[model samples]
Target: MSATIHRIGGREPSLEPMLSLVAPDLNLVNAVILDRMNSDIPLIPELAGHLIAGGGKRMRPMLTLASARLLEYSGTRHHKLAAAVEFIHTATLLHDDVVDSSDLRRGRRTANIIWGNPASVLVGDFLFSRSFELMVEDGSLKVLKILSGASATIAEGEVNQLTAVRRIDLSEERYLDIIDAKTATLFAAACKIAAVVAERGEREESALDAYGRNLGIAFQLVDDAIDYISTAEAMGKDAGDDFREGKMTLPVILAYARGSEGDRAFWKEAVAGRRVADEDFAEAVRLVQASRAVEDTLARARHYGQRAIDALGGFAPGGAKDAMVEAVEFAVARAY
Candidate 1:
């Protein structure tokens, strides 16, 4: 399908439909989250809540809810599972902020910055434990296997990314692999578990997995592009953060390959942590734009977004399917 389909009638795609569809379930999920994050150690909930209550779309859990809705599921089993997914995601964010030494997230001080890295890491571990508890409570060995395996894969991906940091030679293929493990795995699991709860066959499970995995990839790609093109206010974090941190995201990868010799040299220096001034970031943006790196990065996102939409082809048409499709459109349209 054409990327232009996301922009039909010159209207912007919004998450409103999906959010509206899942709001009731999401409220229950939030209740589970609140009840689980509590501990006698006040610091546990305090730190966890800092990030959890902070601005976030709760996209992963909402996918689980929406996928259940698409399957016409009536039971409440997915509620705890959706909350589990959010806990896992939130745990990752806490750990990620510490790893990146990020001070700002969602336009506020990151957990690590406020409570320190040790506290943040420990609280992340606490949330992970809570997620596993929810999974075990649901009494599904299959669900346990999927979520636990995803947690391990996310750690592996983090290590891979850590090793690849500051290496301008990082291949596009390797980068995609890293993101698939780190970000897409959970998305796939979240959706796939909905099928499991609905007791659907393998074909339906695989389809939801494909839809979610592709959407996750598209979501991360848009985020990669936004780092260079958007403002801190707009992005909820400082723009050019990836450049300053020397993270080898897709835009930098493409720009370096397509840039002139001088441009490549500049990128090397920037990625090596020598050129981090605002002027250097401006030049990096110029190079990326000149080489159409950001543009093409967004194009790649649209490709995966289309794949996500196509994966839903077998599902019956309804508000659920339309919301899911528009969710993909919203994911790919953010960069525009």
Candidate 2:
């Protein structure tokens, strides 16, 4: 599923404590990204800054730092690795907006919408190239292997989603398979790379990898939930963007499966058939809610959150590790 929803806004200061372990480093990483965005090429720098300042939660890189700290990694490579993750993520956002023909992202005009698709796509490529440069600076073939593998998986996931979009016969199992490839694989790689850097045991590395994978799945589940449940203003983007784009997310899959005959027919004609009426959007939301899919998806997320915490139990938990646990918990319980 797409995860461009939610921001650092809406919540109060209390949530700050959940990410305190690596917030300072995260801020530094942001500065590094901004500084690197500077280019002699005139409008390139400005457009890059506009995309960078669009206000992201920086969740991917934060996970990298948190995972490193949890295992007592004390090297500068962590920062570079974190920034690499962010670069890949930002590249994906640029490409996703173009593929979806999106106009709004984080409640602002998309780079494609304002600067045009050519610029957005080219800048995104620039970010990808810069990320590869950072990876080379890390000087670890293992790190390169993990990240390159993730990049490939992310691309495959995008292709899988394109093949499945608007197909009502899409099963819940297939939807999950797509997300596991597209979303969770990179997250798993991020944490696993930290484990490799920390020289953790094979068993611990696998456990941490599992933790990241499960956490990523939980994160995406909540993302899908918020898209169906949140308002456009609060979510920092248009609500039902997925529905309008003919993407078959979890909520719609469950609702369409359980909908009454008329509701089902309406979805087939409007949602699947690409003739979405005004009532179709509202009714899809209602049917999904009525199916209790949101509750079911939330339960799945909580299950994954619990599993992630369990994975961390193999290590000697400390303040930083405890903070990582709290971050995962907060990710699930976050009211975005």
Candidate 3:
């Protein structure tokens, strides 16, 4: 697809303030991250450092930390919980890169490409084990169960996507199911763990869980929408990755549904028949624009983002609450 990328067509909300609000707790989370990344085996830390040092926002752990403080949590257990959340996220990133056969992550060479898939997967396993260890040491049965269930769900989601390869007829319902498992489950867990540690009752825990889940859904929705609307520079990776991979993201699903009989055949050939040429991508841009697929995708993202914002209604107005709201706005508007 020899096309210029465009940015998301709306204003973006900065997450800087949110990060700043959680900065102190995040520092403690960072300490735990560095401490736990250590291994006497030597290569484990080296391989893991390559990805960790590449540096994305590390938002999952931050969510845990911020959620904890939002409830005025006094104990230090959230620090370990936050670290565990990060380990789980990092492990998933490692596994995702391997599954996608990706070479770059956060604009650096993926651990798999540099150290080989064997090392990447093993180190990912180590991180997952480390996360479980953190949860166990915290000795919260509720925390352990919630995080472990989320971990298992993440694995199941990956497997589901593996089975979805080349199946472009994937329905939006199923697609959401996959993302809820793979992405939102952890976000939900990250937020819910705060309530758990705070000893906040079920109402607050469920609300926080809903907030994270909806925020995560909005976040991934923007990413899917951006594949059609964003620039290569903005995306930090090539657009049309979903199409190239034959994955049925929202835009593709909508386009496929609304397209004509001939259009459907074209899509089937491009993906299911495994005969994609460059022009197919160019035509994809056309179909996506014609169908207003990107707009619809973002509308869905906004809907979920609004739901995420609404989830915080019970909480009083404060910096942490405000930051969480801004974080949801950021999720939906990130492509912008």
Predicted model with the maximum lDDT: 1
> What TM-score does candidate 1 get on C-alpha atoms?
0.98
Sorted by lDDT (best first), the order is 1, 3, 2
Error of 3 at 82 (Å): 0.8
List, residue by residue over 1-336, the lDDT tens digit for candidate 2. Answer: 222212235442233554688887888888778766667786767777776788777778888888888888887678888888988988888888899998788888888888888998998888888888889988989889999889889999999999998888888898898888888988888888888888777886798789889888888888888777888887777888888778888877887887889878876765565666656678777878899877777777777777777788788858766666666767787643
Candidate 1 Cα RMSD after full superposition onto the native fold (Å)? 1.1
User: Model 3 off-target regions past 4 Å?
Assistant: 1-12
Task: Supply the TM-score for candidate 2.
Answer: 0.92
- Residue-wise C-alpha lDDT for candidate 1, range 1-336, written one tens digit per residue: 236445535678989999999999999999999999999999999999989999899999999999999999999999999999999999999999999999899999999988899999999999999999999999999989989999999999999999999999999999999999999999999999999999999999999999999999999999999998999999999888899999999999999999889999999999999999999999999999999999999988998999999999999999999999999999998887
lDDT of 3 by residue, 92-164 (tens): 9999989988866666778888889999999999999999999999999999999999999999999998898
Backbone clash pairs for candidate 2 read 107-236
RMSD of each: 1.1, 4.2, 4.4
Error of 1 at 239 (Å): 1.3
- The global Cα lDDT (0 to 1) of model 1 is 0.94
Which candidate do you rate higher for TM-score, 1 or 2?
Answer: 1
Q: Candidate 1: misplaced stretches above 4 Å?
A: 1-4, 8-10
Minimal lDDT window, size 10, model 1: 1-10
